[model samples]
Target: MTGEPFKLGDRERDEIKWSCGAGLGLLTRYAPGDFTVTLRLQPENEKRDRLDLGLLRKPQEDSDIGEGHETWVPLIKNVTSFEISYFDPNANTWLPRWPGAQLPRLVKVKVGRSDTAVPWEAIIPLRRTPY
Candidate 1:
């Protein structure tokens, strides 16, 4: 992948604390607009990995519960499913996700890794609202 400059915020950077969470160790801050947030994922074993995303209109009350002025847009399965169903991480589990939809208001990405798991870095591009 292309090695572009990446930045992390205090909240985003704090995800490293959990061994089950993303371990890229790079935190970043992205505003609402056209953006591409990328993450690095190295799977440790063989399992189903799905990603989730949310874009908050405002800061979240609690980051763990996945709250905020958050607008949710799930990820696609294997880039091919992006035009189909969508992604969801309601229980923080890695399975039974990806309900792909055509043209979503994509804001963030949540990765659900199965098997041995890996360090998954999420990259999300902000979608322009076609009014």
Candidate 2:
């Protein structure tokens, strides 16, 4: 399922919670200007499978508003052992937020699958250190 504008409001959160069955839960929250997403998967036994979480962005050049050329900005991959996976735009070592570019506008979750790695484009600008 694909959703546009990528903002998870209260109603969307409620729907996600209701749609989740006995062994699943979806948690979302906003921190300042950024958002956080967490997926909880519970199984009866020890058996589990790997899951990949990706953040995609639409290119500015695309004509379609929400259905533009989507690119995978790899968040986490080959996550086999962890039962809980989360993505927080504010706190991540892999991709630091830049000054002008916008945050990811889309999220993609894949189970037992892998995609080609895409390197983050922007470089974190250096700030002056206070003495």
lDDT of 2 by residue, 3-57 (tens): 1222132111110111221221222232122222223222223564443444433
Instruction: Return the TM-score for candidate 2, rounded to 2 decimals.
Output: 0.23
Candidate 1 accuracy as lDDT: 0.28
Error of 2 at 125 (Å): 7.2
Candidate of highest lDDT: 2
Cα RMSD of all models vs. native, in order, equals 16.9, 16.3
Our tally of clashes for model 1 stands at 27
Please write out the lDDT profile of model 1 over residues 11-90, one tens digit for every residue.
12111111111123212234333222233322222584332332113232335454434333333233211111122233
Residue 66's lDDT in candidate 2:
67
| TM-scores of all candidate predictions against the true structure | 0.18, 0.23
- Badly placed stretches (over 4 Å) of model 2 are 1-53, 78-126
